[model samples]
Target: MSATFVDVEDVRQRLGSFGVWIAPMTLLTTPVATQRAQFARIESLGYGSLWSGEPPADSPMGGREAFAEHGVMLAATERIVVGTGVANITRRDPAAMHSGAATLAEAYPGRFILGIGGQTGDSPLSQLRAYLDGMDAAATQVLSETAYPRLLAALGPKTHDVAAQRTHGVHPFMQPVEHTANARRLLGPEPLLIPHQFLMLNEDAETARGAIRSVFGSDAGLPNGFYANNFRRLGFTDDDLLDGLSDRFIDAVLAWGGRDDIVSRSRAHLHAGADHVLLHPIAHDLTAAVDQLELLAPLLHN
Candidate 1:
């Protein structure tokens, strides 16, 4: 596979060192004006980037498209970069994905990063390679200049190798700092290593663990999901994954407790060789999530 034509330095310069990943589904369902205000508030809070996921077809916002949402977010904010924490490649062909990414890159310029993931067929690595090849070919046909910066949601070593060779970086989701260190070592020093860290502002250990348990449920023990498999690879035994994640597993993966604790966990990723850490604050209410972002802003910015 060939290297992406997008300028990696420009992407690094734009994304900065810290970002927030919010589903923004709540805001999307709200009135247009309110949604815009919410985005503006996040940007004002000093986050370098705002990351959102590609909603499923049955999403509450009437199947809101990721590329379209990226445009809306860019329009709503002044300086904050907006990106897909990952747009599912299985949902769209590579040509469509390339066009959507290129359109956002053209309109927002430095303010858009295209992160894509989700396995497509029998072999995910092979599918990803084909997808990248298709994107490169599509760029030649449609986009004469300005390739969009892309990040892959890679987890294991094989996928990390593919990301190192093809895309701008790897955006491993739901892994601990140990995985971040391993990814950095595998990808070497040049490629960006941006890992997502789940955050819970609650000081109560049981409460935070409960939230994580609800999120993972039976999947925590299953060997199928990416989180389970990655955790196992990182030396978490079946015992740790049983009963919706053990207390030990919760502390290892989540950035919970007081403000200081959250800050410490966030910094651990940086210390582990991550270029940037995307904090995924877990809260049902959008208002509460925004408040959490405000509270963590000073610590993260510093």
Candidate 2:
């Protein structure tokens, strides 16, 4: 049997003209209880989807029972879709991933979205294609039992094509709006085109730059060399990398300042052809994140 994508009408309803991307609550930082609260709050705030991750440190197969904890969050809210914006493909055997994503979809019905990604390495293409094949077989097996949606956390042509041919859409991370335009052109009109936007609500030059630097300093030169290299292509120099994100680089990559400023930057992503925008607040403070969401809620509607 062929693999099943998400039901278009169902996805459209869940999207309801507003799509959201949220940061994953990592094991070190946000606890499950805290994650539940945050997801519930974001759902109340009118965001459409809550996205999280299964990083390398976590179990690779992306457990279905893990999301079961968030059942409290899902139960507390209505109309929000919950996604594993990427549970890495390399971490799990095909059957394990299939069972995990399948269980979540069966349990939640239309509310679950499974997003998959390839882990970083030299032979990423070979590994990613194999992962896609496994993911397809998994989806077929699960969708035979029940319907669910899947997406790929894609950055390049090959994965984007896999997402187009196999799943519902593509969710590209840390990419600029121009990338969104290019991805839309690649994925065409039918699939979901959700992009993650990092933001800071402070306009103070030093404070914003410090925040961006702090965030990127921790992330750059990591295993994901491609993402860092892409930033270089976007004009980040060695100085920018060593000193951390320059003001220009920060401004180029992140949306910063007050509500109006953030919304204006987000509009560019939507205008560039994104079907949905997920906002990742760079702030460590939860209240600040919530406040930013409150401020950005109006923009989500438009």
* TM-scores, each model vs. reference: 0.92, 0.85
- Predicted candidate 2, C-alpha RMSD: 3.4
lDDT of 2 by residue, 1-302 (tens): 12654566668677654444544443235565666676678888788877666555354333333355445445656768777767667567766766776777776778877777756677876776677677667766654666667778888777778778777888888888778888999899888888888887787877876775664464553223667666665556766655444566667778888878888888898898887787877657555576678778876666
Clashing pairs in 1: none
lDDT of 1: 0.81
Put down candidate 1 lDDT per residue, 214-285, tens digits, no spaces.
Answer: 765645554456667788899998888875667888888889999999999999999999988898888886
Report the poorest 10 consecutive residues by lDDT, candidate 2: 57-66
Best lDDT goes to which candidate? 1
Question: How far off is residue 179 in model 2, in Å?
Answer: 0.7
lDDT of 1 at 218: 45
lDDT of 1 at 145: 75
